[model samples]
Target: MSQNHTWLEIRELAEALYCSVKSVYIYRDKNLFKAGTHYYSVGEGKLRGKHIYNLELCRKALLERTAKDSRSNETYDNKEINKLMTRKLDNKNLSYRK
Candidate 1:
């Protein structure tokens, strides 16, 4: 919402953001820096103007961001079910038929 004191350097930014600088670096490295700002490289690996953070973006990122990702690896044999069901009926049709 209000982020008058939102613009901050690395440590301050991390503190205000309630996250670690390392996490910030991790996000930055992963290109997951969803803080709604374009990074303008300061120089020699330093960055500036990264404090364009806002509550909306932070909330969205926090809500959407996952701490640990679960890779979808479940391989199911749907061909059999598809063969039996075909496109003839939906779940409701099957249930109603019962």
Candidate 2:
């Protein structure tokens, strides 16, 4: 949100981020990016105004979201692995008793 940072139009941002324009709008609509910080509208109309985004802030938010998702996935994978290991150990113990 700093004045030194570049603010880009939705299409430009989408291109810069390697995503579709619709995805950019979805981020805004879903509140993934906070208004007045990551993006803001300009022009003189209620529904016709265009939104400009702070590229850096948007990137940061996206990175943070991705990191959170990956962490949750890792936790789920670890739990599954642990369950499989425990099952294998139980089977091995049964074989030993036979």
Candidate 3:
């Protein structure tokens, strides 16, 4: 295995996820990110917390989560709704589906 980077921190994960530090914790609370899947702690449950994550994987997870959110049965504002509609119309495959 490769040597772990000591400088890689949670902030990097936050940036990779395009989310705030608080949101990362919130996602953690919601079990949005699986421990071993997206995150790895150098020292599990220690005073000095150290976690090494695969940034690429974290980004992929975040994107997938956002996609799920966008497709959810939830209300959206006019701006967002219009944008989604426009995107759907512009997407050739979706446009030709019907």
Candidate 4:
């Protein structure tokens, strides 16, 4: 993901990851990702809180979890996932892009 990209809301992240919002919450509870690293909470109203995820860190967390799960036969090509995530972030002014 590019530096210019904005934080992703939980719903946006769920959509990007092709998972349900509940699954995202489950992943959080399971410690698949950590707060302030993979995600952070935002104030919605006077007392309401909402979550926003860091796209790059979320991708990193998923990669790490997949690496540590020896019993899982699922295989992921990280390059492809990275490309897709970067595209979803949609940062148009990336420095490396000419």
Candidate 5:
């Protein structure tokens, strides 16, 4: 909600993201970005009832989510993979009867 942030309509947001308007709506529906926090609805006679996106807020939220996902899915080294595989094999062998 900084003064420098540009407010965009759904179409404009989709255009900025290189996506369809429906996709933007979908993101809104999925709560990937929050309303009021990331955007707000204008209740003017001219605008009727269309939400406006605070560009910086939306971009920041998306980037933070992306960074969190990347950290959670951190790449494993060969040794770590080998150790996980060994554990899985051992568990599988233990389940079998002689």
Candidate 6:
């Protein structure tokens, strides 16, 4: 861990990020942040434990995720438009045959 990075508890992280605690947990559960990089479990056994998060890592992960999602959305939109254009051309061809 870099000395400049801040590690924070769930509540503190939420406060710092201006989000709810549940949102932070959602990010963890969804695997948006990798263990040992963005966060670490602090407890014994398999029962349950507190998670300390690297604030900088979490922010970076979120930014990457957002960029990836934006690219995927653009690709999806392009595919949909192509499908619609293909359908229209097919309809036109059928009309000419009639």
Candidate with the greatest lDDT versus the true structure: 2
Ranking by lDDT: 2, 6, 5, 4, 3, 1
Can you write out model 1's per-residue Cα lDDT over 5-98, one digit (the tens) per residue? Answer: 3444567656766888887677666866644462333335445434444434553555556532433444447897778677576556664433
In order, what lDDT does every prediction score? 0.55, 0.87, 0.70, 0.79, 0.81, 0.86
> lDDT (0-100) at residue 23 of candidate 6?
93
Query: Pick by TM-score: which candidate is best?
Result: 2
* Model 6 weakest 10-residue run by lDDT: 89-98
Each model's Cα RMSD = 11.5, 6.6, 12.4, 18.0, 6.2, 6.8
Give per-residue lDDT, candidate 3, residue 79: 100
Runs in model 2 lying further than 4 Å from the true structure:
1-3, 74-98
TM-score of each: 0.41, 0.71, 0.55, 0.59, 0.65, 0.67
Q: Write the per-residue lDDT of candidate 6 for residues 42-94, one digit (tens) a residue.
A: 98886668899999889888889889888777345787888877774555465
**Deviation of model 4 at 60, angstroms:** 1.2
**Span of ten consecutive residues with least summed lDDT in model 2:** 89-98
Task: State the TM-score for model 2.
Answer: 0.71
lDDT of 1: 0.55
Clashing pairs in 4: none
Q: Report the poorest 10 consecutive residues by lDDT, candidate 3.
A: 88-97
Q: Give the runs in model 1 whose Cα sits over 4 Å from its true position.
A: 1-5, 34-39, 43-59, 67-98
Report the number of backbone clashes for model 6: 0
* lDDT winner between candidates 5 and 6: 6
lDDT score, candidate 2: 0.87
- After superposition of all CA atoms, the RMSD between model 3 and the true structure is 12.4
Ranking by TM-score: 2, 6, 5, 4, 3, 1
Of 1 and 4, which scores higher on lDDT? 4
lDDT tens per residue, model 3, 1-98: 88543334788777766778888778666877667776766866687567676676666667888799888867879999889877744454554434
